[model samples]
Target: MTVSENDTRSPLLTVRDLAVDFRTTDGIVHAVEGVDIEVYPGETVAIVGESGSGKSTTAMAVIGLLAKGGTVANGSISFDGRELVGLSENELRKVRGNQIGMVPQDPMSNLNPVAKIGTQIAETLLAHGQATRHNVNEKVVETLTAAGLPDAERRAKQYPHEFSGGMRQRALIAIGLACRPRLLIADEPTSALDVTVQRTILDQIATMTQEIGTSVLLITHDLGLAAERAARVVVMHRGRVVEQGPAQQILNDPQHPYTQALVKAAPSVAAARLQPQVFATERGVADGSDGSGGSDGFAGSDGSGGSATAKPIDNIVEIEGLTKVYPKRGSKEDFYAVKDVSLSIPRGETVAIVGESGSGKTTTARMLLKVIEPTAGVMRFDGQDVAHLKGKELRSFRQKVQPIFQDPYSSLNPMFTIERIIAEPLEFYKRGNSAQRRAKVRELMESVALPNSMLHRYPSELSGGQRQRVAIARALALDPELIVCDEPVSALDVLVQDQILTLLSDLQRERGLSYLFISHDLAVVRLISDYVCVMKDGELVEAASSEEIFTNPRDPYTRRLLASIPGNELKIAS
Candidate 1:
């Protein structure tokens, strides 16, 4: 599927010297300028970049779906020999679902919460004239089945709330492909899902689109994903196309500095750097460059981006036979969310627990944080039984342990300034006087690499990464010995995620911090963990050093997780 520069077929989508502008409150902002791309029938092309790099904006301009205050300032968007730049709303509506389709990023935000899944898909089918009212029900099920959802008929009747994140994503894919359009634009389609689910959804897209001979324009921040899925990769940076070439070519030897940084920052490529022998020999993964200018895999950031942490000599926290059981309704058997799980976090090191959704990883973290009481277990922190702590001891334990949550947008208070957000804990604990607390807040901000100028800015004024930095600063305000990091970098792009990981690692070394890291992303787990714990179905199935786990995994499930990593099969050696 490698499409060369001289690809002969007339592109299904072509943008020639496109320029886009937005009317911001401050002034007119040029979002995209002089950008060009093509998508041939049945070919896949990716637009990869950071959040504000104009990748998504370029895609939106193609479908005439620009946000308010945005418009195409110049150039032409030719789709199947028809120009779409100046089309009216009515004209564009006719062309949208019938000729082109889009699957946006967040499924929860896109799906209609008040409507049934079938009704939503039916609306698209009816609008596109793909099905009549009498046969629309049957068509809906067919579409869902094609999108790889099992029991489509029953699933169709459920609301969006009833479906899991992966299931909801499948429904979006079904709706996007229902019209069988000539082009499909998937924007960050699998950014939030687990590796296994992400692979399933992408596979379904590839199969369904190839069957229909539909072209794909994938928008994502993951270079490894683009390398694995798309035939060509278009690297964007600061509202411009920095480079364009074959997927493997860009992945192996990127020309642009930003592109090289992205490759090195990717989890799949970085994790591969840990122990290339495991993947190169036993798993059929060939030796390849990690885009860090090294023959062997080396994800550059001080030459140890994904290497295992040094072993620590002390246990900061330990658990014995942890279990949590919830009673079912109407005499059904009690459900076990976490059962007999035992693990320990070494002092001044990171321990990662990885599993898919409903795998009890989060449940176990909650128990460790004392957010939820375990049914039967002995939890010890600093050699004290945490379950028996009450009054001042419990409050002191709370001060010593803190949580850095998943979503940066929700973790901080929008109404408060960054200074207040960071200073709240210090104020609550009565750590110092007003002036001292403010100084402490500034110190925490500086520790997390935030500027002093942004002290008075609200959370809404900051980007996702900035807000996450603020979250870390808040967590560090209490000077906790242990931090329960629940997917702290899951929502961030590669570059920002790399910064956060680096910050965490530095903090651990400086302050002797212990991290109980929980995530479904094995790649990130590989990058930041000293010991790896593999969980499934409420049980701890495998536990070992990060180096041993990634290289020579003994458990089949662990091997499967490694195999599903994006770009796991790509040979970037040359």
Candidate 2:
């Protein structure tokens, strides 16, 4: 819990009384407030908070990327004793990539869609005057290789779409590290990636940063990753610093109530899915009592009320001999995204579909949603044939079942306010007019624990967690019998995920709703689902009650997944 040697009298970067405001039409939205933080040289500092905690805004303000209508109204941001508060955009841009580099959370936003990635990276080096035309390509290849991209020479010429999510993230990291800036700000670099890929990407950054002695301001909601990777932790709430200290201390002995709640929500996802007991950790204060490594295995509890609902064993939705294949002209064979898969979700019960990236979990969900027709399958929803349903029948089928997507950021329209986002579903079905819809929107917001005042705010104005809540509210607008929650809480922070999970559980119990929850985090699935279905290579490898699946994972893939989860006992030594 003690501060390490890196915490000297003077820091590499320091901020005091920092505040930001956006002059919107309605009023000024106080985004950040009276914030003070410091990042020492050769130290990694993680800013941890739920959505709307101003974590990303702080990072953006540091790099001068504050969005339209936003301005830093108060306080000072100093880098190496130089003030940056009143600096011009041109000056900030020069200082940004040269002295401070950033790796954004979503690669799609930062990456140029039309331009070649190699040329884009070369531009970064060229901007800083670090590489000539002759050496630029070589530098790009070397940097890409260092970022862990395979066939860096040829891959550099490819467009952003040609690369996978993890590779795209690596490419972004390559650009950020291209300048070899003294400070690197990585905002949720691994949020979209699977666990294995996440580990690999983070480890690459960790290794390279150490070799170059680059300080990192790591902003993410994943407490497990923060605990594993960061040296120091800063917890922010409502744009203020709630807690700040050593990563081990914050993870193991968090002082603030908010910090304690977040730490308690860190799940060993793999272990929990395998068995519930792994999640039963003793609650302790700063002294770290009940020491058995003070680690909780999976059961990924969202700090919600504990109650078990008994349900019938019959599958509410059943798919038999499900096969989906896409045929390309002149091709010898079709692409089997999902092949002969069978799965079931019990009535008023939660069923989780889990797998690595591109393992067909989403494809299965799409087939269930009927967005994409299955090439061959016998699907039943509420004991009626669904695969055969089309047009009006399909519309009615959709009414019975709804879907919550992985990224709420993209799910909701940027132009719409919170009220519009929630009301779109109600209006589509002609459920109510303006006044009724407004009332329903308010009720939905209350149900999702979003502030009623947020109804008028745009998606760009809200934080990550808040936006997801808006998405949840929109999903709940139809009051469907079952919802296909696809990574509903993945983009959220530990505490926010806890709140959302608790809300979903409460809603299900009160409304008699069922869920087909799809996620990569096994711990989340274990906490929310009554039944677990593990998928691998377009096949259902294991399916059982939560208790049985966790207690006795039958498949080798399931066992390996349980083994890979980050647990308290598996702490990487400093």
Candidate 3:
């Protein structure tokens, strides 16, 4: 798969001096500028960058699917000996999905909601002239099966809402490959999926593309993943090509500062385990403090927390035999979203719950946050039974325990300014007068490292990281003792993710904040957690210190998850 210069297989797709522009209310914003890339026959190329770095813009221009107000400013996109810039919509339709297929980022938005999954695939195949009405259903089943979806026939009959995240992504892949195009553009294909499901999707893409001799152009923010999947890695920053080279070369010896920072910030599963002892909690009790503060020196972007060890460990939140069950629509037995789960968060240390999408991690977090009522078992917060709290007591518990959700874009209300958003929590709690609340909001913003300049700006204007900071600031506005962070950094770029992790570590050290960090990423868990809890199928498979979980995982499911971390294969081979 090493595409040598001398190995002159003609480029399947080529872009020369490509530039894309969007017509904003103010003026024309140059989104992509002077970008050049090529994918040779059967070669896989990855364009990697942070959000708004023009990676997605470049791909959109190539496929003639630019959003409204966007147009190709200047570019020569020659695909298989033909120029695609000036093609009419009808003409482009003849070319699209027939010769150039695309698997868009979010299957939820990309896939039609009202239609059956089978009919959606049928539309693609019929539009591309890949199938006649007589054989389209058979083709649909074949395509879904090839994309790694189980019970393809039955799944085809279901609606998208009925499908799981991974299953929906597979359906997109099935549609993308239905026509067997000469080239496929997978845009952030598995960014929101679980690590194991991410691997399965990527593997399916590789297998299907290789079977059809189709080249690939992958677009992602994950450089480590690019290194593992693509033969060549193209690094883009600020609408320009910053670096381009072999995949391993980029990971092992990156030249550009941006690229180097990405590699440094990316948490590798093969990296050393971080050992954390307790930080001093508010109660002033010291648990066995052997001062075992072993660290890997993976100081996230802002470089915070070196060896923060602390005093006695107190259980800020505890759950014993917690379970949530619902009656199935047509089945005899109930469905357990979370079952027989017992976990505890130390007063001043992070306890991370790591699992796949349906592993009940988020469900556990919701129960702790009191978002939903648990069906079975006991839940306690700071020695008080959570299940028994009512009215004023429940309100008091909610004031002490806040939640930071997964998608900041959706978690934050677009109508509210940063100032108002942060002040709302204080206002609801009737903490102080208007003057005091405003001052507290500003202090909370500073704690999360957001500038005061952003106070009046709405969530629509700020970036993903900034909005997350706003969310964090609001969570801290309550001055809560325990914060349940649910996949906070999963949507961010590596550098932003690094900075957020560091900020969390800093806050925990300075304020003794106990975090119930729920994430599917083991790497992030290792970087920020003292204790790690592994979950599978609504059950706690393993619980131990972060070091012990990473170094000597006892559960087979835990081992499989560690193995599924992207780029683990490269580390193993090396």
Candidate 4:
């Protein structure tokens, strides 16, 4: 994936003075205003911003995917000299998925759950007349294989539920690239994937586009990813273009205030956790506590200065020889999701488990939460074995340990308001009367940095970050000593991720909270964790203090995981 000198060629896609609006009950909401962008042939350009910044809305308008009540009030979208703003539905049909292919953010929502993977790809091919009825199957297989899925035939027969998150994303990529369109719009294509899978999927996209001389308009909130993959970067904020320049320049020496805030907030660019001085200096400036700058509260010192050499305190949770095995449907042998995992978390400290998908991280977390019974081994919580606790003891244990899930959208209930969601735990525990519960809910909301006025709103009205904050607030309603945060910030954009990480750090400092953090993002692990545990193939490959793991990793797998972070290979401007 090399950057091409496509400036000599005419632009493949151009948007000039674009403005979009949506009619709502309140009034007309302007989503995009006077936004300008261009993508040259065979070049990759990225549009990056926080959620509701209008980047995704602009892309949707260009691809004719605006939802009902949304309209392109004013703008000129031209692809290959064809104006797209005023095109009819039939005319746009011929252009969409044929001339301009789109890979949406969420695979499960976009994909047909009832259809086979191959059939879906085949439908896309047949709809665009890219393949004849006879060779459609062959084309589907070829496309899947090209997108890096192994044993394409077997995978094609499986439904979406049978596929892992990474595999499902690959199928979507295959569908997007099946026709080899002249331009591709990938909207946060790998936001839900692990780092390793994200690298592979991105590499596949770059290779395919470079081979076909196709232009790419990448939409993401990850600045490191934008710097690593794109030739040019466009920064959007509040429905306006704030900055546009070469990717490295914008990352290294961003002139715009918002762009500078984004660079400072990106954890991937921060120093490793082991070096206290370096970490303090870099993080202090980013967080605006160094006395040298004052900006959005996106970055702040985590105060983990002496955690590397700090002595272990009292044990909050301890696991020994923990294992989980499931019977194979058609075989006598068992499948082990977790095997002989041993680790301990100290009181008021965070221990992070980092690994790729299907590597037993989530399984280990589930076992700790007692969501599933471990097939073998013992789990001790504050000095008592909890593996077989029942009745009152189990209920007591539940109050001490809570969980924050990965997908905020699915974890929350649509029928419930924010107030009800937070108050349910209090009601379940019979903690207090109606007035007391309401007061507690408002306190929880304040602790999570959300306004109490939103108490009556449902989850659908909030953004991804806000929804996740609500989830956190609900988890904290029980005042749990140890929270099992499973990929809590992976789906968020860089700025929102920074805010959440900072919020967690602040809470830990103030409340003396302990966390069993499980995530695939090493950079984030470095920011908030005191100890690090690396897992592979359901086994603990390495376990050490956070400093030792980041600075002196002994295991090959650990080193590989560190090296796979995005933008690590590139020479980012200082």
Model 1, 157-261: lDDT tens digits are 999999999999999999999999999999999998988889989998999999998899999998878989999999999899999988988988888888888
Which residue segments of model 4 deviate by more than 4 Å? 1-6, 272-312, 432-438, 570-574
Query: What C-alpha lDDT does candidate 1 achieve relative to the native structure?
Result: 0.85
Which digits, one per residue and each the tens of the lDDT, describe model 2 over residues 207-291? 7787778899999887777776777889998889999987877776778888887777666543333222212122111111223
Q: How far is candidate 1 from the true structure (C-alpha RMSD, Å)?
A: 6.8
Deviation in Å, model 2, residue 541 alpha carbon: 3.0
Q: lDDT per model, in order?
A: 0.85, 0.79, 0.85, 0.85
TM-scores for all predictions: 0.92, 0.80, 0.92, 0.89
lDDT of 3 by residue, 314-385 (tens): 577767889999899989999999999876776778888999998999998898888889999898889999
C-alpha-based local distance difference test score of model 2: 0.79
Q: What is candidate 4's CA lDDT for residue 339?
A: 94
lDDT of 2 at 159: 98
Worst 10 residues of 3 by lDDT: 294-303
Clashing pairs in 2: 51-465, 269-523, 272-298, 272-299, 274-550, 275-550, 278-297
lDDT of 2 at 400: 80
